[model samples]
Target chain A: MLNIKNLHVKLEDEDKQILKGVDLTVPAGEVHAIMGPNGSGKSTLSYVLSGRDGYEVTEGEASLYDHDLLDMEPEERAAAGLFLAFQYPVEIPGVGNLTFLRTAVNAQRKARGEDELSSGEFLKVVREKAKTLQIDADMLKRPVNVGFSGGEKKRNEILQMAMLEPKMCILDETDSGLDVDAMRLVAEGVNALRSPERSFLVITHYQRLLDHIKPDVVHIMSNGRIIKTGGPELALEVEKNGYGDLLAEVG
Target chain B: MADTAVLASKAPVAEKPRSVLDARLEALDLPRGGFTAAARADAADRLNAMGLPGKRDEYWRYTDPAAFNAPTAEPLAFTSRASTLFDEIEQLKLVFVDGRFDADASDALDGEGLEISTLAAADAAGDHWAADLYGKLETAGQNPVKRPFAVLNTLAATDGVLIRVTGKVSRPVHILYRREAQDADVTIHHVIRLEEGSELTLLETGGIAARSNVAIEVEVNKEARFHHIASKRADDAKVGIGHVFARVGEGALFKSFTLSVNGSMMRNEGVIEIVGDDAVAHIAAAVLGDGTEGRFHHDDTVFITHAAERCESRQVFKKVLKNGADGIFQGKILVKPGAQKTDGYQISQGLLLDEGSQFLAKPELEIYADDVKCSHGSTTGALDETAMFYLRSRGVPKEQAVVLLVLSFLADALEEIEDDRLRDDILTRLDEWLTSRASA
Candidate 1:
């Protein structure tokens, strides 16, 4: 349910282009993995879709369901059932993890014209979601991502995704800092959220993450565009040979 | 009291200069007759010599004292619906309206191992212990700064409280100041003494005068403990000028925290002396100024002296300013020559929410003992962009995210409060302030 048509993006301050006439779509109930080499505008696609600032969408039509995603603010996009698990989840001191999540959940609920959750209700739901992601109560009590290990941050992000239950989920290289065990736990958490009503766009630089989650569709993205589209066997081929032959074929 | 020409000439009690402060002094109704006569006369002579702090004064460089030097401060009224702070806590309450003590509304003046009396009620008690400690700390606290306003309060204050504690106080002594008079240019003075091995917690809120000057003198005796918390509740039209002079005795503890929000012009000054060996003192404040009602200016000036050996002291101040509001902090830690093995720390930080807001800070550490460890720091900046974005991307609106970041910046200062419940109470008011003032 995530669609981008003729997408073109540029740096806000400079004229340098990032995403040049790329087209991609992730249909409902499907998990699509976009494996790319470094500096292939993979991260830019995720950022632009999430409505981050400091990016000029030169020409694009990005939409989620019936909403014009590009015209909405970041929070509005989140309320419209969009979630982005960051590549590097930044540490924010002073805001306790529980309070941060509660504010986020309530803001989204309010934006969607839903009644807010009581404190007790919020604590219960968060504890359940956190347990699945191996996030203990102490982790929920501390400041958001402050003093957390890379694995803990990724788990925290998954906990957020579970709590929000967004329809269109975009995992932006969440496996970068995570170790083997952490990546499996993260994948399990992400895999749990997969339903017929939910879709995923997992942007990864390696095929190791897709091994645990097992994407339904694998797209070879190189030089700002998806050069090849195939099934799960394609991820195994790239893991065996890397992007060398794929880039050569695209060139 | 003014019979001797030599005494008046040396520190001319009547030969005052023509200035805005001099005019304000004329309007003040100084405590008259009986118990206050001698102290009031001496304070007048000192104030007459010093005059009021002018706009040109180095200490008032960032904040123009001229706003408070008029014949009478501008009257302000707060019509907000938020309830008063500390209303839920069980404590003894003393009410004052328009600087006059409201005896009918106050609690009974009887407690275990403690004695409490009004300054007016204690006028006839010649041997009262308060008489010995009254104005002593204020006079002793004046060192590097010429505190003319405190002196002016000593000479002009009409009514106040005198408290003495000898054992641990079960409940806090809350002074509830409610304003009933508009244009009430009231001056007040309070005297508190904690004897050896005693403990007391004092809570104060509201009743900051429309155009008010307040002075509190405290003495924590050997091995005694004293805690003071004051919240100058948000009243945009109010001018709250206050001073606290305290002395911590041997092996004693003196801790005070203040929360100031939305005052049009507020200047809070504190002078503390660690006079006894191994004494500990901490002073902290959280000031928030969102210039919604106009230019909100808050100034906190503190001077802490380490006169005894092995004593420890800390000064923590945090400010959140927006909409062109001004925040000023001047803190100094002084360690004497024999005050060896002293440990002291001071930090003042400001978070300016918008481009128009301003924060000015001056931190000083004067150490004479080579063996002591002391440091001071001051910084001013806006909220962290990464932190702001992270909060917003999580679906928190920009306004709520800003408040969250601002409060996160102020957590350290709030953590300095020794009591957990009191800190939470203040946090409630802090959130209310953000919702009401910072939303714009």
Candidate 2:
């Protein structure tokens, strides 16, 4: 469902390269986790795939569902079924969370040549989806992430993911700043969306998130490239021994 | 009427001026006759002393007062026919034609707890309640900067209205201006008084004249409430200057908001004084000056005084400028000595769409009471880039996203409106304006 070959990305304002010669692939219907140490280009990978500004793809190519992801704008990418749950969800003052969600949902639907949802229909769906994540009515009424707690913001991201139902999902450090109970709730929400036609690229530095929503395959990312590949047990090994043994062995 | 028309047809062309300030004022014609001798002399003297604010004046530095201070202007035949707002509900409609009350087109003035009459009618009635309020508030509000045009309006206003409310008014009052001739200079003055525990809402719409000067004097007595919402728009050739002088009594509430969409030149001034303890006042404006042929200039000058203990006041102004348009905001909050526990807030912000457009803001706060809470802030910037990206990433197109951000920036000022229906009407017009702007 997602493919990247020798993806080289650099800071748009400087010569520093964040993602250097990275190659990875995730087939349809599989959950793939990329475990990496600090500053190992984890978040950078997510940003590049999501078409964020201030990043230059110096070399290589990335595609989703065989579409030229690198050629599309960020909104076009979202319309093409790519979702990125940010590590730090944006706080947009004055734009109600419900208003933001309805606008996004309708905009994507229009771009996809689908009928827009009426207010009544949209409100019903949002409320139902929000119920599973414990996002109360008042939370949906407030501005987007304006006064949200850390866990609430992560869960709000998950709620958006459920609403959009993208084909390829990227969760960048979703487990950070989340307590054990909050992490489990987020994992449950993610696990409920698993389907035969969907895929997930879970980028995390810890294995606790994988405990609730197990991944089909695990890859060890170092210095902007995937250097090791293994099964779910690989995540446990990294959790127990950390990245020191793997980095030393690779050297 | 025939004689007036003959005089209008035979009007002499205003000669080239050796001095802009000297050649004006005495030439103006008051259609409804003049005010009391002393009152007119006082107003005219105050105006002559200040002259017309020049570009060199500190308060008028950002905006040139040349258009407002022009020596002579020919009448213009306005052709645009725009619909008036707040027509969806029941209202008492008062129409004015070039600053003269059109009694034939106005509604009957009969309502419970309210006494409304035209300025001409009130003047003809001989001594009345309006005599006490006619220019009292205007005279009391001229402390820091004297508004020469407002004083001129007080002296020369042809016809307006005097409204007094003794109890809750069920319906809003609408003042409609229908312009037929261009280059016409109109001076209008209105006086409103609210007795103890009374309430009122006043709505104003339309372009009054090509060159217009309006003065609104309001008094909110103990436990009274008042709301003023005005939306003014005009083409590139029009110039309008308006002022509001309001005094709030003990435990009274007064709120006023204005939406200025398009004009060649518009300067709106608001001066509010809270004299009674526990009174509250809020004055806000959302202005936009966007035009195609030439720059649209808008200025909002507000002064709010807190003189009583535990009184609260707020002043908010937000402006959006584009296509070389210019916007100016000058506001101050004063907390008088012994006015302890006074709370005041002032914020002025501007969003410039292009480098050619400019925004000048002067926000000030003077506090003499040690236990007061006061804060003032001013910012001039482009749209928030990060917020723009976030909205665009969510699939809202660039234009729609910008509109969202702009509307969000103005939400606070819009919230000052007390009536939901009136607020929604203004909001719909604003939305249409933004949509057309996006296409243009």
Candidate 3:
């Protein structure tokens, strides 16, 4: 379960609030979608929740599984079952993708006091998960995100999330820069990881991604606060009517 | 009483030789009417005039050779003892101890199309090519900022391995320079000649645990290809100084990769001259300085397109300075006037892991040709903060993340090596060293 109460965040050394007294809660076994227009602080909220540096949390309480999330470091949060699928993944040369994945997974395992996986066992699990994401074995052998296409990088992120198997996941614009086929494959990979004990926060500007991984709840965010909460039908309404009408309601 | 007197006269009395500097001069058996001997005399005279390079010298500013004045390595003494490192290499091994040829420890020259013998033997067998190409590429009495060590090597070197690849020698030739412990100084001069249209790979490993000085000269002929890989793993308590001079002829290709890992104070100077048109030269170096007192320095100068057109030269240097150690890289590329369409690129990069660690990188490009594409760049920086954060976010410990980043920084130089097995071996050794240091 994930909970946020009156979450207030602002850029360091700036007075402009990005997440203004926001409140949200996601019980296990549900997917939540946050939709907003450009400059609505959608990405800022994700970064604030992930505890990236330079985003000062002015006032708020965030908890994952009854543990204070704001007190944890980035790595500690990751090991605590919090995963953020980056919108723009970093390119790391000379570090193989599989090696990076194994290092991350084993690091989380070590932090959780679990035994480390052997090379053979890690490879076996990675190959099996990569099959669903349609990532070739050679791609994993190459350097992390080096020479990977836009869609391939997105898919690789999903592959990592699947490999990590985090309890709570945040997909940040996972559908951006993806063609129809790539979007379908990525959505399928996300859909395959869905379970009753896990939760996801899907952030996007378009409603197309929601068509594949239908969310149990849809929240319309504007001016750094959620103004509307409805069922899945709200997504279709926004796709057809656009945010212009929603802006009026929020204002 | 008469028998005792006779035995006393015949016994090998090991008198503590005079100053290593003086003993080196006395060991030379100069031959008459020989161009090599005349060159040696000229170099010795020039060395006497210039004297030893002090800390004030511009070239020796960063690396002071005066601290290495210990009288432990004597020059020009042939011994039966060979280096243990050569036992692992399966090739034609030539052992040189104290700047002289150790024939007893070396194998006989019986390979087909491969003339593996001493430089003196080659000259005696009417091999005029050996003498003609000896000092062709070295900085002899020229270079305003002269390297006294090179001058010393030229004057004091007695005999070294002279390998001629008449045809394509499939197996590599290993040259092992093993320095024994004695209360004296040592200087060595080596020459390698590859005939026209011949190709060979030469692996040179310096196993000098004692305080010693060494120099090597190599020459490659027209259309000949040579790959030279040199590794230095000297003792941590001793000082090791070495200089390598190479001449690559027209239409020839020469590639060199050097790895300097352990030494108290080590300096390797490499000079490459591309004399012929369409010639290619590549030089790569990786030095690792650890411990609080270790110091390593590398100075490489390359002269490209002396009289040739469309020649290519590349130089890359990577160093990791840890603890309170220091690493320096000085690379210069020279393109002559008539050498049009010359291509040259040089890059030097270093990573300093500690606050007390220091790295100095200077890349200079001097060009006279109008239609040349030459560029040189040097970068000195700490580890990437974003990358470090990303790795840490993935649950990798800080130390392991640093190791990965350091390896990534050095991967370019290691990947430039063409030999897969040698490259892998070097990488493995580097990884082991890094892991140990990380734990420490």
* TM-score for chain B of all predictions: 0.93, 0.92, 0.82
Ranked candidates (TM-score, high to low): 1, 2, 3
Give the lDDT of residue B257 in candidate 3.
85
Candidate 2 wrongly placed segments (more than 4 Å): B1-19, B31-37, B73-81, B234-237, B291-293
Relative to the unseen true structure, what is the C-alpha lDDT of residue B295 in candidate 3, on a scale of 0 to 100? Answer: 48
Model 3 residue-pair collision total = 4
lDDT of 1 at A53: 81
How well does candidate 1 score on lDDT at residue B163?
92
What does candidate 3's lDDT look like per residue over B34-59, in tens digits?
44766667777665555555465567
Q: How far out, in Å, is residue B270 in model 1?
A: 1.7
Q: Candidate 3: which pairs clash?
A: B73-B184, B73-B185, B74-B184, B250-B276
Better of 1 and 3 by TM-score: 1
Q: For each candidate, give its TM-score against the true structure.
A: 0.93, 0.93, 0.83
Rate residue B161 of model 2 by lDDT.
86
* Candidate 1 residue lDDT tens string, A51-71: 888889989799999899999
Ranking by DockQ: 1, 2, 3
